[model samples]
Structures are given as C-alpha cells and as structure tokens.
Target: MFSNPFTPIFGGKPDVFFGRDKILELFELAMFERGSDERLMFITGTRGFGKTALLEQMSIRAMKKRKVIDLGPDDTVEQFITELCGYDEVVKTVSPQANLNILGVGGGVSGGSISKAKHIGREKLQPLLLDFCSKNKQGLLVTIDEIQKVSLEDVSSICNAFQMASRKGYDIMFAAAGLPYSYDKIVQHTGCSYLRRSVHEEIGLFTWDEASDALNEMFSGIKGLQIDQSYLDEINKFSYGHPYIMQLLGYHLILCINENKPKARHTVSEVELKKAEQNTLLAYQHRALKPLLDEFSGQERKYLMKMSECLDSNRLTATSDIAKALGTTQNKLSKVRETLIAHGIIAAPERGKVMFCVPYLADYVKQEAVNSSVISVARQRGV
Candidate 1:
C-alpha cells in the first residue's frame, strides 16, 4: 500500500508541489539580476492560500547562492538583529561576550547583550543588516512568513530598515508572506513608505488546468490507486482549485477509495466520492472557516450573512441586494466589499456583483445564521 501522497498540513512542503512555476521563475530571475526591482517580494493571501509553502520553496532555492535566514511570524525587528548577531561578520563588530548571550536570551529581554554591546535602537536594524550583507558576496535572502500577524509598528520598523538597505544597493533581499490586508496598511505607514514600491504577489486560487495537473501528478505514482478524468473532474469541482481544499479532498478521497478493504478495485466509486465530499466539507468548516469567522468584524459578518441570502446557483450575489438588505447605500458598502476582496473572502466578478470566493461559504453562513436566530429566540423566551 502506498502512503497517502496528499500533504494536508498547513505550510507543509508537498513532495509534488505544483502550480507555481511562473512565480519560481520570476524569483530566480530577481536573484540573478543584481538590483532587480523584483528582489523584494511580498506574497499575500487568505488562510491556507499557500503563502507559507511558497516562502519555504523560495528559501530552498535561495540557500544555494545566498545566506538564507527565516524569521517566524512573531519575530519582531529586535529578533532580526539578534539573529544577525549569530553570524561571524556581525559578531566581529560586536563584543565576544554578546555572541555567547545571543543564543541564551529569552523573550523577557529585548535585544539582549547585542543591544547593550551596540547600543543600537531597533530602528537602526539596517546598519547591522547592511554590514552582514556587505560581507556576504553571494547576497542574503531574508524570508518571513505570516508577517501580517505582527503589529504594523514592528513591521514598519523593519521595513524602514530594509528600505534603507535596499537604497544603499547592498547584497540583500527580503521576501515576506502574509494576509493581503496588511499590504495596504504597511505601505501607508510613514515608516514603511518605501515598501509601497515593493513587489506584491498574491498566492491565490489555482486555475482548473493547474489544479487538474497537480492532482494527476500526485496520484500517478500510486500503483494500487487508480484515477481517471471522472475522479479528477469531481475533485476539481468540489475543491474549486483552492490549495488547502485540494489537499483535503484528495486525502479523504484516497481513504474512501480503499475503505480498509484487504483488496479492492482501484477505480473510484460514487459512494466513496460522496463520503470524501462530506468529510472535506466538515473538515473545512472547523479547520479552515472557523478561524476566518473569528477574524470577521460584526459588520463584515452581517455583510456575509446578507450576501449568503442572495447567492444564486452560480454562487454569485448582487451588491444591490446586499446593500438593500442592510439598509445602506452601495457607496457605504464599497469599503466592505474592498475589504472582503482583500481578505480573499469574496470576489467582484463584474460590475454591481460579488461572489463568495470559497466553496460552501454560503451554506456555512446559512447554518450560522440559523443558529444565531435560535439563540436570539431562546434569550427572548428565557428558556
């Protein structure tokens, strides 16, 4: 029996990663061309849109020609310098004692011995970074994932430093991934003004062709498992090319096909496919959609609930209907629409229309709405 080929873990680098060849090509070109405008790339998207996975992929390629350092989402500007302290080039400029302390300092401390040794403020992050970059002839690639989770102030402090470093034309590159909302907020900040010019890559839904090719390649190696166009069509339709859903459906479908049988026909059955679909939807509701709902504001939630009411068979909703239901003008809802679009929750397919970008969002909204009504009625009845 073949081990499950689908990688469902968030940010887990899949063995058969696909649909990002164009992006990888662009990044490689940026690396090869000195002072290329595209060196600083920011990938943004909703949860599980493959931002973190893409960052990991870039780090793998960047390591071959440069010093690559990956900073976790919570790591602030201070941590960036502390990471620099571990390097020989930067250590030469600082006291030897600081080098020993850098590794041992905990979260309570800010900057540790490196901060005391250099007396450098967090805003001056570029100087040490530049020094390190100057020494590295092959250049340095700094990749950070989920940057939107950090405070904008912390983000800007580092952005200002990076902007200065980039202006100086040092051998340095910064690639970051985060929710799309932060891109506008960060760029508008005075401290991160320079980031307005940086590259923005949205790791979004895959095309049908991209999704089909990926699924075909993923299952092709399994001798005991067999799939054809019909299975592929069902999986693609249900997943809608969302990377996370694609993985989830593919994983569950494989399990359903086998059904713990000692031996069975490799071909997929309708019963198995239906079971997989049910499992995928349940998993999506809890694992994927719940966190997103938590992030929604009251108004945003209301907007979505209202939109869900107006959903057509095609999954599209009219902006006019939403505005009318909300007792607001379309102009008033424009900002909400823009926010939803940025969040990857909805798309405006054409003039005066918006569509839920994720599969089953409409059904989820309806269920939540019904539950809310039940709670409201119980409260009134004092049951």
Candidate 2:
C-alpha cells in the first residue's frame, strides 16, 4: 500500500511545505544579520494557520550558525538558563580551560549541578551568556511557542535579558508565535516594550495556485492514482485556502478513492468526491470548529452567530446587516469586528462586506446554533 503523502495534523511539517517561501526568506535574512531588529519576530494567526510549523522551519534554518532553544508557555527563566548554560558549545565557549562537562562543571556534571545553575540569578546569567556568545562568535536563537500561555513576568524577564545582551553587542534573537489575543497582550506589557520593534507577520489565506501546486506535488509520486482537474478544483474550493482543511480534504479524498481498490489506477468520480467531502466536513466540525468556538467570549459568540445568520448565498454578509441582526448599531459592533479580524476569524472582503476568514466556518456556526437549540429543548423536556 502506498503511504499517505499529506500531513493532516497541526504542527506536522509536510515533506513539501508549500506557500511560505517569502516568510522563510525573511527569516533567513534575519538569521544572518548580527543586530537586525528583524531577528525578533512576532507571528500571529488563527489556529491551524501554520504558526508552529513556520517556527519549526525557522529554528531549523537558524541552527546552522546559532544555538537554537525551544521554549513553551510553562517554561520558566530558571529552566531556560539551566538548559542554555549546560550546552556543550556554551560551556566550551565560556570556560575553555575548565574541563567542564555538559553541566558547565567537571566530574561528569549531574542533575544537582543543573539544579544549582537554575538558581543562578538573572544578573549573573546575563553576563554568562554574553561571555559564551562573545567567545564562540555565534548568536542564540530562542523561540517561544504559544506565547499567550506564558506569564507576563517571565516574558518581561526574558526580554530584559535579551535587551541587556543587545546593549553589550552580543548577538541574540527572539521569535514567538501565538494567537492574536496573546500577541496583543504581550505587546501591551510595559516592561516588554522591546517587542514593539519586532516585525509582526500575519499569516493569511493561501492562494489557489499554491494549493493546487501542493496537491499536485503530493499526488505525483503515487503509482496508480490520477486526480481530475475538476476534483482538484472542488477540493480547492472546499478547502478555502486554509492549510489544515486542504490536508484534511486531500487525506479523505485519497481514502475514499482507495478504499475498495487496494492497488489500482483510478479516476475519482463525483460520488466518491461527495463522500470525501462529507467526511472532511464532519472531521472539521469536531477538530476545528468546536474547539475554536470554545475560545471566544459569550458576546463574541453571539456576534458570530448573528453574522452567520446573515450570510448570503455568496458566503458574505454586510457589516450593517450583521449589526442589524444583532440588534445593535454598526458603531457598537466595531470593536467586536476588529477583534475577530485581528484574530483571523473573519475578514472584510470590501467596504461594508465581511466574511468568515476560514472557509465554511459560517456553516459550522449555524450548525452549532441548531445543536444548541436541540440541547435546550432536550433539557426543557428532561429527556
């Protein structure tokens, strides 16, 4: 059996990760620049827009000339410093003649050694990193994923430490990825003001051409499968340029076609395509829509349900129409609109017209509304 070529899950980098060449180039340039502000970047997008994948790719690129450190929301400054100081390269750079082990000391450095290093204060750790970077002639690339989950105090401490290193002419870079709400929170912090200068990149929808090319490439090497142009067109339209949806549709379509015939050349039919579409829709409802809706506030959810109700045949609704549906003036709804737009949930197609940024989300919202009513009725009847 031929293995599936597409990666349909979040954070899984495909063998051919397409449609991000421009951003990758920008990151590469930053990696080579010693003190460029571009080295610090903040990437924001809705869930499944490939923020984590992009960060992973950037880390891979930076590893050639710099030490790369990966941090998460729960990581503390002490843990980070201990990890950094224990690196073999950092130890060699900082104490060339000390015969230090992996823990920055001799006698085969143990867990206790790292524990002690973790207690080392910021005042001391800062100079230690500077000496290491200065001696090794290589910078450090620190990437923090899910920035929103990290506390403000930890963020401030990390930023201050990097700022101190920058002042002393040591090369250091910071890159973080998060949803728009989290990214906004980080920027709003007064102590972490240095982030204000970092380049902000918003991941947007992919072009049809990019999607088609990726699908074509994924199908090319398969021995006994050929997809029709019409099928590809349907998949592209169904996916609506969201990367995760594209993978989902492709995965389901392949399975739909290959289910009866284990190994044979086959041309996809409308029946098979429709079956795949149904499966993909169900998968998306549970995997994407339900969790996404849980993240919104009550008012935001109300506003989105109103907008979904107002969707036209073309999948777009006027802002005025949505406002009227919500029984509010457009001015009153402006902040909610802005919030949704910033989080990549919805987009303005033109003046006065708005649509869900993720394709098919409006339908999902409507389905949720129906489900909610059913639940309410069931509770009332004590069923």
Judging by TM-score against the true structure, name the best candidate. 1
Tens-place lDDT digits, model 2, residues 190-210: 978889889898886789998
Q: List the residue pairs that clash in candidate 1.
A: none
Candidate with the greatest lDDT versus the true structure: 1
Clashes of 1: 0
Scored against the true structure, residue 378 in model 2 reaches a CA lDDT of 100
Q: What are the per-residue Cα lDDT tens digits for candidate 1 across 107-137?
A: 2332333434422446457677777777778
lDDT of 1 at 229: 83
Kindly report which residue stretches of model 2 are placed more than 4 angstroms away from their true locations once superposed: 12-16, 35-37, 87-125, 329-335, 348-353
> 342 in model 2: Cα distance from truth in Å?
3.6
Q: Name the runs in model 1 displaced over 4 angstroms.
A: 87-120, 262-265, 378-383
State, as a TM-score between 0 and 1, how close model 2 is to the true structure.
0.85
Q: Which 10-residue window in model 1 sums to the lowest lDDT?
A: 106-115
